[model samples]
Target: MYDIKALYEATSVDDACRLLKEHPGSQVIAGGSDVLVQIREGKRAGKELVSIYMLDELRGICLDAEDNIRIGSLTSFSHITKNPIIQKYINVLGEAVDQIGGPQIRNIGTIGGNTCNGVTSADSASTLFAWDAQVEIAGEGYRRVVPINEFYIKAGTVALEEGEIQTAIIIPKKAYEGYKGHYIKYAMREAMDIATTGCSVNVKLSADKKTFEDVRIAYGVAGPIPMRVPTAENFIRGKEVNDENMEAFAEKVLEDINPRDSWRASKAFRCHIGVVMAKRACEKAVKQAGGDVDDRTEL
Candidate 1:
């Protein structure tokens, strides 16, 4: 049961910021997918909610003057899956969101909520991390953009200050250029299941598409926060995309992830699956970048 002392419908981003400032005990709600669940389960602690679901200013997918893809905080997963801009440039994001839940859940879950929930298993975080996305935040009188990887301080905790709201997510143009990415979520079931482990790989190939120019590898449910494996990425960078190098890269990834044992999966299992998922995701990304992958080869 939702025991709310008050509910304020914010008409704009400014209004939402003002409400948060005025009511320090109030929490912000857009899609309410995560918050409502938390509230019902007695996990979240606020009686007052400032609703930004109706704030049109905080919704949409567009490109800024600098060609950065800006996704409003209130943009739902449904819109994200169908948006041509997302489909064309950052379809890996679309691919991840599409697997989130049933259609109804996707229709109501916002990207902001997914990130703000700050769960290690959030399906979207690893993909966004691979793209090197930035988050735009708005407060009473100031706005700031911070890299997505830096947004999380710990599990279930975000860097948003009091009275601040995330306004949009920004993916720089440079992050998209020559990048082909893939995201994979491993769960017990196909639907309505949180990831036991997830991996996302984005690779930039050389002009000839034979060698990796830049590579990013990230994982979810692998540590205290969504993690990027720099050691594995460094090993793969400038290397030929072949069975031997890919296997070496996969082995090196074990040095980066720090998954904990949970009821759903053991730490050893998570690490083992994480390595496999990374290899598969990397192979898919390499193939998407127009490189040949040998399925017969095992990493």
Candidate 2:
């Protein structure tokens, strides 16, 4: 059985923040998919937990007055995958989260927990990075926003301050408009296996749909944190969509990733697969954006 000191049920967002502030060292629990497993594994065995699962304010998807897509932290993977806003605009994010575990896990696994756990192999992390998402946080009487890049401090770590909880994930209008994206999760098995490497790429074609106006490529399990290769993105920003440009862009990613040798896969294997995923994901993303790229070319 899992060991825990106590559980405090929070009734609202303010209540949750108050509980977090009042009970120092208490861990926040929402959707328990990650926390419960950690507790059972003895990773968080004796810690006090404050449950925010019932906080309705932290659960919805909407577009704010600024035209940013605001996704509540408590939104489930299943809910995000089926949301019309996600399907229409940033479908790559939806597709990425959908590949997370099985149906039951997706139903209860929240995007907040998935992100806050700070696992590099998380399915949603890469896409969020690629989309230039922002993390909105609330603590006591203050709220702040952090870019996705700065939000991730390192492997299994985020930039959350004491008593602060992530309230929403915001995808700004400028980040998603005119962009088409794709996600590829390379895993040992197709069903419920975790990703050995996950790649997310998005492209915004020029008005004529002939050249790339912008590109973003990110990878999970590629380094200490899910990160985008700005060097590669810069190289392909104004380049014509073609086999040569795609290959070069994929090669550039190798300079940024520092995957290590692990039981699941070796460092060399992860690097090679990461490049292939990048190329393929970019090609698919370009196609979805109505840009012509030679898909028959092999790396």
Clashing pairs in 2: none
Residue 50's lDDT within candidate 1 is: 94
In order, candidate lDDTs are 0.90, 0.91
Clashing pairs in model 1, backbone N/Cα/C closer than 3 A: none
Model 2 agreement with the true structure over 175-285: per-residue lDDT tens digits = 999999999998989979999999999999998888989999999999889988988998889988888889999989888888989999999999998888889998999
Deviation in Å, model 2, residue 129 alpha carbon = 0.4
How many clashes (backbone N, Cα, C below 3 Å) per candidate?
Answer: 0, 0
RMSD of each: 1.4, 1.2
Clashes of 2: 0
Error of 2 at 135 (Å): 0.3
The per-residue C-alpha lDDT of model 1 at residue 193 equals 92
- What is the Cα-based TM-score of model 1? 0.97
Q: Give the TM-scores of the predictions, in the order they appear.
A: 0.97, 0.97
Residue-wise C-alpha lDDT for candidate 1, range 14-129, written one tens digit per residue: 88889998998788888888778878888765579999998888889999999999999889999998999998998999999988988998999999999998998999999999
* Angstrom error at residue 117, model 1: 0.7
